[model samples]
Target: MYFILFLVCAALTIIGSLFRLNNLKEIKQPQGNFIGQISLDFEEIIVRTSVKEQIKIRDIKNIDINIRSIKGQYDGYSTSKFYYENGLSNGTENFIIMVLNNGIIKKYQFEYIPEISFLLNQKLIEHYYKIGIMDYLNCVDILGLDKREDWEKFKKLRT
Candidate 1:
């Protein structure tokens, strides 16, 4: 009897928690113009990425309004992210905040760029070195095990 009671209580508790978490936005809604429109209460804060339909929230806060900008995307991987935590209020004038891709946020300074370029040159250098070694073994004074050596070296370098 005790086990059955405990199981019921646990199930109720889990359901209650899920309900509260899933309804966080619903719980916080402004009255007046927002009446009957619970879904639109949460405004989308979007950051533009070159890849269409992919966006990171960057940060979220409960406020009277959300001011969003369409900063167009950049090249490379869009990494280095941070959030401006709980800093905006609709009634207040300090809603502006800056976002830097290096995980830094400046107050009200906003800009967007494609993801930064990686060290492609370094990768190309490594590739050239491997090709040079393979060519040397293939065309120059070849060693008895040059082919095997080249294969092993190239495979290891790939990793």
Candidate 2:
């Protein structure tokens, strides 16, 4: 029965090693440059990229923000030519960005890079929201641009 005992120990060791490796994958180090910035004023949300690509979403009442997690070689690349020139390594780094006017009803996608994945997660957790759910609410919380009551009314609309 020594062979059976050895097999059980071997299987456990292999499973433990895999669990450790999975944890390592989740451990992210912010590599490359801080290539993006997001700001909010009373009137609008401003997103600025390291390459000088800027987008301003006007009329806070109508705008919505969405966050997406991008990972792997098969995932798409940034449409902006600036990202290519800046030498952003693809697939190695996985992170989320805020997409203004995201989804089918909206024709255009304006994704804002947050420089680090943790920053985006921290912002969402701090605001008590999840991805794909009331993105505008998260935006409102992160930016601190509007009153809680105003956002609450919007949140209740179920649009």
- Output the number of the lDDT-best candidate: 2
Off by over 4 Å in 1: 30-159
Give one digit per residue, the lDDT tens place, for model 1 in 82-118. Answer: 2211221212121234243455552422221113211
| Candidate 2 TM-score versus the reference | 0.31
Reference-based TM-score of each model: 0.20, 0.31
- Number of the top TM-score candidate: 2
- Please, what are the lDDT tens digits per residue for candidate 2 over residues 52-147? 434433322233444342332122333232222212323234322434453323222323344643335544332323323335555565444477
Model 2: residues >4 Å from true position, as ranges?
Answer: 1-27, 30-33, 51-54, 59-63, 67-159
Candidate 2 all-Cα RMSD: 12.4
